[model samples]
Target: MKNHIVTAFRLTIVMLAVVGIYLLIVYGGSKILPTKGNAEIITQNGQKFYANIGQEFKSEKYFHGRPSSVNYNAAGSGGSNKGPSNQEYLEIVQKRIDTLKMEHPGMENTKVPVELVTASGSGLDPDISEEGALYQVKKIAEVRHLSEEKLKELIKNQAEKPFLGILGPSKVNVLKLNIALDQLK
Candidate 1:
């Protein structure tokens, strides 16, 4: 019994040391990031917006982000907590799909990008997959009276590449894209 107690005590010390070192490393890493790992904020037209957090954009002139389970409230960031098989979740997704179809007639018969209809694991996702942005190009171009090619080019320029070229998929920041769109005219 004494030997077991000593072994457990030693293990506890080692575990504590490991966790401490990890915390120190993480803190050091944050010190080197642009925002010091804090929220990236942007000021436009006297209004401050947290660029890292998703905002609702229902205007036809703007690009929309993922569905927000918490209505884009930063304090309540979370998924819907419903499985794909849940009837309520399915109904919500179906309604979103129907809305998209009605809004973008050009998207007829096209498979809507999954990200556009689904709430992200963190409902506050401010970015969308590259393909998701492309899917909306036609509708935006038609509404804004801009060429589709120009919109596509903007998307290409604004796309954030995958981390280290292989860690994640490419995505477009919707806020940045919409800001640029406003400046295009």
Candidate 2:
């Protein structure tokens, strides 16, 4: 019994030390990042926006990010957890596809980008695939009265290339892109 008690005490101490080390490593790594582990915030027209989190942009003039299962609630970031074969999930995705077609008119025959219709695994993805952003170009151009070519150019400029130019696909941070869009005269 005494040996077991000592073993348990030693295990507890070791675990505490390990956890402390892990926390220090995470905190130190954050300091090296651009935002220092803090949320990236952007101010536009005096309105503050958290650029790191998913934001709801329902306006036709702005590009939409991935759908949030938690309704953009940072406190509860998560996915819908519905598989592709889930009937209810299918309904939801279909509805989103219908809405996209209605909003983008000429895109009725075009394949809607999957990311645009489905919530990401985290449901708080702030970046969208390049195709996702391009998919909405027509609608945004029409609503904002900007030329499609100009909007495409803006997307190209705002796109973040893959890490090391060989990892992951090129993606556009929706918040950053929209901010640039608003800046356009």
Candidate 3:
């Protein structure tokens, strides 16, 4: 009986430690990261969600971001949850392609990256590939009345490096690019 009691006590202690550590990590990480909120200007009312990154949509004058999902009604962070081979996924991709073509008629299908259309795991991928940025450059330039070459330069500079030397592919923060676009004039 004593042995069993000791074992139970040890297990309880371990479980408590795990819970405490998990909360610590979650709270600490949340505070440390830069999360997007409605402050980025998704709605006309200027409603803001604290630490709810990638949960809103904005306008064309500003570059748009990837699709995101929250509780849909309550606004919890989520993604499309569709796999690459899903037919629904395929249809959405096609729709996005058509839309992009409509927006920038000159951007060849080959130039547009897959990341631009497909929903990311979080549906909140704040960054797109440099190619995606370039694909939209002409349209953004025309809209902002800025030079295409200058827009390209800005996009290139905004791309984040993979690592110190090499790792992940280069990515451009859509939010940052749109902010710069607004500031360009």
Candidate 4:
């Protein structure tokens, strides 16, 4: 019917308009952000690294980040897809907690920060909660032979506060923190 054809044409035009407007908004928004939505590349010691993506840090002298479901592979960014109630997932987390206990002897009484044991939704998060960084201060200080107070100060300095003062939790970018730690004497 002619009416049906006209209706389909009108709907198609509306859908196209909506999609175009959305894309324009996204492009415009990206222009205001740092690097214009491109990955932030960082250079150190003749090595190039993407500052926005998570990197593995297993040394006791450096802060650790959240576990990666995709093994920190940016090409496969995703969570483990297992809920906390899942026995297998719980066991994995327990193993991590046990490992942390072994690595940091004095932290038996202190609560381990949850973010340290769980993977981010993207599984490539570069930042950790401020509490998570503080939790590892003593261990890092012992290994690095730096004063705990000084290391705490470094964590404080590296912390990125919640956006607009209340939008999200404060976090510390592990890569940046570790780089600064290495530079410390």
lDDT of 3 by residue, 1-185 (tens): 99999999999999999999999888776664333112333432375432224434345556665655442233444577777799987888888888878878677555567776766765556777888778777777777778889988888877788754486888777766765666665
lDDT, candidate 1, 131-176, per-residue tens = 8898899999999999999999999998999866796899999998
Number of the top candidate by TM-score? 4
Give me the overall lDDT of model 4. Answer: 0.91
Candidate 3, pairs of clashing residues: 70-76, 71-76
Best by lDDT: 2
Q: Between candidates 2 and 3, name the one with more favorable TM-score.
A: 2
At residue 112, candidate 3 shows an lDDT of: 61
The TM-score of predicted model 2 comes to: 0.90
Q: Residue 70 CA error for candidate 4 (Å)?
A: 0.4
Each prediction's TM-score against the native? 0.89, 0.90, 0.71, 0.94
Backbone collision tally, model 3: 2
How many clashes (backbone N, Cα, C below 3 Å) per candidate? Answer: 0, 0, 2, 0
Tell how far residue 55 is off in model 3, in angstroms. 6.9
Candidate 3 — what's its lDDT? 0.68
Better of 1 and 2 by lDDT: 2
